[model samples]
Target: MPGGRPPSLRTVASWILTHPDALPEKERLKLKSVLAGCPELDALAEHVRSFGQMLTQLRGERLPEWIAAVRADDLPILHTFANGLERDLAAVTAGLSLPWSSGIVEDHVNRIKMIKRQIYGRAGFKLLRKRVLLAS
Candidate 1:
């Protein structure tokens, strides 16, 4: 990232951004001359050219019309409920696989809760630690 060839997509995008005239005469001629001289920049220029064409096409189009077609029948009540529940379960399972699993860490919290219940207001920090480790 610091000292390497710029990524193809980003290089093309930045060139397009800075040079507002996508197919200006001077820029196009420079690209053509560079392409004639160097094969690698030629390939990059070709990609940038295609990307410019796509951007031009996108500028003239309207948003897709499919957004207005989703009715209640497209997503029933029960299916929507199940989809949300599935998302929650996937998030919880992903958290379990992280370097610090909340499940194991929650066990430590459960131990602290037990210690608090047993000690009430009397035990100091040292005795609480002794009780937790010995209990573990």
Candidate 2:
């Protein structure tokens, strides 16, 4: 086989979860071979897909169980992610369960920042606020 640096396990796992059908037949076969060669990668791919499905389906109630499973695994990276989630579990659960999103708020904040930068030295807060209101 032609050789350079091999694909990282994470990259392969992500591909398997998100875009398996997007791969060319040859590449798909290669990925299957690689996965079959590594049981850990296979298990990691399964967990990744499961978590993705949970998020997509807004299954926030299952987050605790999923976090526990991740903690039980030998994967340090996933354990760290689970720990961070535990620190703000309520917010995370709310985000998953609520239909509302912060996208609009974030967009407004970004626009205000852009306006501030454009008028940095030329305008004061009052003018900036006026322009932001008008732009919106």
Judging by lDDT against the true structure, name the best candidate: 2
For model 2, what is the C-alpha lDDT against the true structure?
0.81
Give the alpha carbon lDDT tens digit for every residue of 1-136 in model 2: 2365567867676577775667888778777777787777776777787788778788877889999887777888888888999999999988777778899999999999999999999978899989999998
Instruction: Report how far residue 45 has shifted in candidate 2, in Å.
Output: 1.9
Query: Cα deviation of 42 in candidate 1 (Å)?
Result: 61
RMSD of each: 17.5, 3.1
Candidate 2 deviant stretches above 4 angstroms: 1-14, 17-27
| Tens digits of per-residue lDDT for model 1, 7-119 | 46554445544444656775555445545765554544444444344344442121111112222223344345435534665453344234443688898999888987898
lDDT of each: 0.50, 0.81
Backbone clashes (count) for model 1: 0
TM-score, cand. 1 vs. native: 0.30
**Model 2 CA lDDT for position 83:** 90
